[model samples]
Target: MTISRRSLIAVAAAGSGLLALPLVARADGTLDEVKKRGTLRVGVTQAPPWYSKDPKTGQWSSGLGVFMGKAMAQSLGVKFEPVEVSWGNAIAALQGNKIDLMFVLDATAERKQAVDFPATALLWYSLAVLARDDLPVKTWEDLNKPGVRLSCAQATTVDSFLTKHTPKADIQRFPGNVEAIAAFQSGRVDAVGMFHPPLLAARQKLGKGKLVVPTPAESVPSSVAARKGDTAFVAWIDKAVGEYYRSGQTQKWYEQSLADFGLDPKTVPPIIKEMIT
Candidate 1:
């Protein structure tokens, strides 16, 4: 799976036809193909409580993302292979055939063009503004005020959304969420726009930070992604996700993962059980 520049350009030109090629096969069955091959390679970020490495065990253990991946692997009878990827590289890694799936990604219309999303909506996330408590910022509208600096991850859906919705705000790009948060904490940026949980977790750790008064103006559904033409695998994922949601394990995983991260389980939205089932 060595994707060269020329090959990428060629694939881009062919587009749908290129995507239809079978990338991997299941061994014992359509599912075990991944297991017999050794691991279900997953693309994830270093965001703690979402997808990060564990210091004590020298293994990866994060939030619902890893939990979902493990569940999928187990249901499919495969081994889990968590690949640590930067926010910027995650999508590219998927496109370049470096990994089998991405556990977390906003299912924006634009992204749907490149990847296939399973029927289940993994989570719903709100874009939040995090700023110093002393700042005059109070709402999403305040973020549009003159001279306000905001930071978001490069090439992320959030960046695109902010650019379209809040064109007045100066947007800075960070390689990943951690650096963006670091910049905001150091006062290098006036505000940081990111998903609710991690930002809320940061606020709790810092004590006395002002989360913009009003909630996110827009909410986006997130989902697991596989290569565009992996129909059988994608169908299996849809069925597995459906069964997981139906069995109530999905909600349980969410509650336990949030609790493990010291986040309030109440903050998690009700699982959209209907979509998966």
Candidate 2:
């Protein structure tokens, strides 16, 4: 489908007619309410590459989610309103009518019970490691040694993954991604393992280490979240997300976000699963 700038602007112009209507009066669907309210409230948090808040300005800055959110809102002829929310409360935000949508949330079975997700994925992110230049890691097994040291966030999927697959390696646990990466920066650990997006920025900032998605890469598809039973909203999001991927806009936004984060896109692993090599 061709999405032209003129078409998007036309849609936005049409939304002005419904701007004065009360949100409660729109019972047709979430889309109707959004048009009436003239804003698309998207849940966001301080997650780099996906969503990040500027400390000095207290504004939603460059990230894949921010770009996509703006594009989605524009297509709907509404303003983009970012509602700050953490991973734990993202679903609750939707349930409480606090936010209309959220991006990059994993569609786990447990979460499915509480919220709806698009049939299409926003992107894929894989478990990757930022290891010392000298470490010879071609696969997960290469790191499963008694001498190798790894650091990851405590009680996270990364921690569990290392414990199961690289049991012999000395895995250090930290409070979060920042602390875990810091351990590697301090030379206390030979590698730090986490999702590749955040590691992209870390590698650029530190100017050392090799970011590798070891052979037989383990990855997960992440999707958009909406309030449960909002079939109309979920269907629209699915179509929009699918179009973004097929047209390569998803990758473009991701690469743009990397550049905005001061990282070279060529040096980082692609977030789209199929693009990884």
Candidate 3:
């Protein structure tokens, strides 16, 4: 079904959790509590295209996952409250039982120890590179040489990606994207590795960097996360996510989010083109 902007808002607003009922969990865990409490607590982060906040007002708005979370809650007849979490804390927040759902998570083996994923990927993302246009790096091989400086967020997928793929590069590690971007800006590093959409935002901020979806165009599946061990709750979420894909809501909102963020539709990472399948 085609979704209008008005319908998107009304649905998201309906589950904004402004009037949360008292949480009452059934023996089934979060699924029952979500339905009973009338609020689906969704963990969000400042990751662009997934979640973001206005710099001036600090008011949060749509990221693809935010819209998807709203739809998932709507399907369950519950509202979803966006709970902010840091990238470093995403796993801990879920493991500690701080949030009922993680709207965007990759099903890595280490993470699967703590959380369960749906049978299908909610989205796919390519590890992207943002670099000075004039850098000698024109291919993945160029960046895989000694003294070719690269920046990555410590403990993030990009860090491991670069470590594995560009081992000879002098990889500088920082606590998060802010520091990684700063490192790139100050000439401490020649390039930065992360996902594409956020790299697009970084390109705009830096004003002259080139966006590169490294050759071979690799991408990974990204999924939603729920605490492990509760097969019933996990199965319910799996079915809900599967239905979300079937309804065509995913593509509609994904395009809208890209437009809202001003990313060039032509340059969207290949994984985006592969999402609906």
Candidate 4:
């Protein structure tokens, strides 16, 4: 199933919450605070290919977010400091000033109530599945049969999506991506479900599987999160991230992260929508 540029762009345009907006110049004080503090605190968690902590060094070593955060900090002439925060608490961290910003957070309507997100999208990730090579799937409906088994992290967006769309399938919910992917690797499930970026690494590591974004493709643009009402900071982040996307730097960073994870970039799906085919 090859993705045409027109189709991918249409899928991307289906969502409005995280897409870039008109850059209104504002002087929100968060930028000044970060400058005064001499460090830009970025919220991070152990989500590979996006955010990860090195076991040996106990540092936020490599990932797309790490690269972007460091670049943003450097551009501001400050240090990049990664503060530990779970996806659940990232909003709280921004609200309470525990961190100055968080990268790669989706700008959902629910999340918009708590924190301000930049108008510019940090990157795009789509709901995709890594299915056994034998299972021919062209769409989500193709996997909605009673005998098919799909695995995903419990209580995640992926699980929720699978549950809603493929209710007849044997949807096995595991504790996390590792367990979900393990189920597929062990031949207990026909496929492992997650956003495309994480599944890319899994596919490379497993050395087999077909990665496909089902028809009626669902894609979301993720963005940087700042404190609510921090218009200036958000605008600044928006401009910087927009530049990254426009100049193709975001793809470079993502490719580097995949390489760092020991995956060949050619074997994985790209984060950029236009590069999907």
Measured by TM-score, the strongest candidate is 2
lDDT tens readout by residue for model 4, 204-236: 678888888887677788888887777778889
Candidate 2 lands at a TM-score of 0.79
Q: For each candidate, what is the lDDT?
A: 0.68, 0.84, 0.73, 0.83
Backbone clashes counted, model 1: 3
Q: For model 4, where is the 10-residue window of minimal lDDT?
A: 17-26
Residue 220 error, candidate 1, Å: 1.1
User: Which ranking of candidates, highest lDDT first?
Assistant: 2, 4, 3, 1
Residue-level lDDT of model 1, residues 15-34, one tens digit each, is: 33334222333234434457
User: How do these models rank on TM-score, best leading?
Assistant: 2, 4, 3, 1
TM-score of 3: 0.67
User: lDDT: which candidate is best?
Assistant: 2
Give candidate 1's error at residue 27 in angstroms. Answer: 11
Residue-level lDDT tens digits of model 2 in 1-277? 3556764443334332211111122356899989999999999988777887788999998888999999999999999999998887776677667889999988877666567898888898889999999999879999999999999999999999999999999999999999999999999999999988778878978999989988678888889988877798999999999999988999999888878777777867787777876
Clashing pairs in 4: 28-232
Clashes of each: 3, 0, 1, 1
